[model samples]
Target: MRRTATGLLVVMAGLFGLARWMEPAYPAWSFVRAFAEAAMVGGMADWFAVTALFRHPLGIPIPHTAIIPNNKDRIAETLARFLRENFLTPIIVSRRMQRIDVAGAVGRFLADPVPGGRLRKGAGRLLADALEALDPERLGTMVRGGLVAQLRRLEVAPLIGQALAAAMTDGRHRPIIDTMILWADRTLDANQVLIRESVAKRAGSLLRWTGLDERLANAILDALHKLLAEMAADPDHPVRAKSEEGMAELAHRLQHDPELRAKVEHAKEEILDNPAISLWWQGVWEQARAGLLRAARSPDTAVAGFIGDGLRQLGDTLQREPRLAHTINRFARRATVGITTGYGDQIVRVVSETVRRWDTETLTGRLEQTVGRDLQYIRINGTLVGGLVGLLIHTFDTLI
Candidate 1:
């Protein structure tokens, strides 16, 4: 294309030479001479304009020539600024993200099974690689830290109070109370001989001689059994009422009593500090990690199948529940907007710095490769248009 454009310029120059030489003998040659003159001027001017974008024309150091190479850093900054202000802005990104169904897209991606179950296999392998790449000790430490942080943030007293309150409200506490009572009865039955021996020891010598101690022991046992039966059969028994009231008071104190709440908090800290608990938790973590690693590595494992089923179920839920999808999409949009707002400046800086680091030759080559052809056409257009205008001017001059 460049050669073609340059060739046209040569042809116009030839015409101009021919016309200028013939104009002395023929008046009509003057019009051709004028057209060719204008054509050469327009073509040369456009050629300079085009060449200046990539380099200095004819290798001369001219002001404003080699526009792109000389102004590369400025161009980079401008480009980065443009992106930050236009495309990377929070408002623009948020608005654009509003129309995107992020959760729906994720649902479709997860739910749709690929040929030969390759997607699941590929995902498993990817996860396996990621897990293998992690340093086990560091990962364990991070996991432990995260768990501790969450635990520290949790208000244990209020949570326990709420749970206890909920259990009572739903009448679930009755079964627990009944189980405790049954256990107590079994314990009492198991220790009956010990109780009888204690009664015998406490009895006087006269009572022991008449076998009155045995009778007293039996009578005490019978009365205790009857009382237990009464308590078990009567829902409105005083003992049961007292127990319920004590439980209610404890629940209330767990939530509202500062002293009790502090005690609970202290107990929580003690539990966290316990070596037994720590060892148990460490064992659990190791087991869990090992299990996850196995699952990730083996696509056909039960754990892997369970994970796949869970993901499919989640995808189905997302697809079926528009409200959930919308909520997820909203969260995604907000998260994206936050990232854009936070890192946009750094992103722009990185872009500008990358461009600034490029050598002039590379930068010039890239820009020329992108838009050089269109610039050649500009030269061609200028030559033809200039020639036509010159012809019209010549005709007007003759008529006037």
Candidate 2:
């Protein structure tokens, strides 16, 4: 195309030269001479205009010529401004984003198993990377520090009291009280001889001298066993009721009594202050970290399976719930607007800065490569238009 445009210009110049020579030989050739002269002039003018856009004509400096190379910075700034004002403006960006069903699109992407799987795998890889990057020993120390900090905030006594209270609700603690009683009764039965000897020794010289020590010890042991059995057999036993009443009082104290709460807090402080408390937590964390590391490496591990299932469930939720989808889309829209409004200008400046950093010659060559062929067409149009105008002027002159 460039060759064609250039060749047309050359041919027009040659034709004008021929017409100039033939004009003197034949008067009728004046019209041909006039057309060729105008065409040659028009072609040259367009050639200069096009050349000036990218470079100086014939390497000679002219005002506003070499427009692209000389005004590179100005051109970049203008382009950048145009983009910022017209394309990246909040209104324009928001409008474009509003056209998209952001969450629905995401839901569709997730519903397609391929993309969902890819997303899941990507998340897993990220998790694996994070796990791999951590030093287990350091992680344990961090865990220990975190645990101690958390434990310091806790009052174990109140928690236990509250737990007991909750357990006692609706007679839930009755079975526990029964079990305690039964265990105590069995212990007495199992060690009857040991209990007898201990009681007889405590009986002092009076019982031993009476020769009634063995029978008396037996009677005492049977009475104690019978009492234990009574406690176990009767849920409404006085001891059981007393125990429940004591627990209820303790729970109320934990919840409402300031002095008891203070004691609980003091105990919490003691536990946290212990040096070995940190070590215990560190050990626990190390064990958990080891298990996690093992789980991450195994594809068929429960943790991996759980993660996969969670991802699928999330995808399914997105697909099924329109309200959730809308909420997600609303968030996305707001985020998009915020980013565009906040940093859009700076982002646009990247274009101008990049252009400014480009070498002049390189920029000029690239511009010319992109638009040179189109500029050649302008030359062709000029030649044709100029010839027709010239012919009209000649005919009007002849008529006058």
What TM-score, computed on C-alpha atoms, does each candidate reach? Answer: 0.65, 0.52
What overall lDDT goes with each candidate model? 0.88, 0.81
Task: Kindly report which residue pairs in candidate 1 clash with one another.
Answer: none
- Candidate 2 pairs with clashing backbones: none
Which predicted model would earn the best TM-score? 1
Candidate 2 lDDT over 9-62, as tens digits, reads 888888888888888889778888778778888888998999899889999998
Task: In angstroms, give how far residue 341 of model 1 lies from its true place.
Answer: 2.8
Q: Number of clashing residue pairs in every model?
A: 0, 0
Off by over 4 Å in 1: 1-4, 7-37, 113-130, 156-277, 280-304
Query: What's the lDDT for residue 183 in model 1?
Result: 82
Per-residue C-alpha lDDT of model 1 across residues 1-400, encoded as one tens digit per residue: 8998999999999999999899999989999988998898889999999999989999998999999998998999999999999999999999999999999988876676553467667887898788779997788778887887788778799888888999999988888777777887888899999989999999999999999999999999888888778888887889888888988888899999999989988888888777897678778888888887787677665333767688778888889999999999999999999999999999999999999999999999888889889999999999998898888899999999
Best by lDDT: 1
Residue 344's lDDT within candidate 1 is: 93
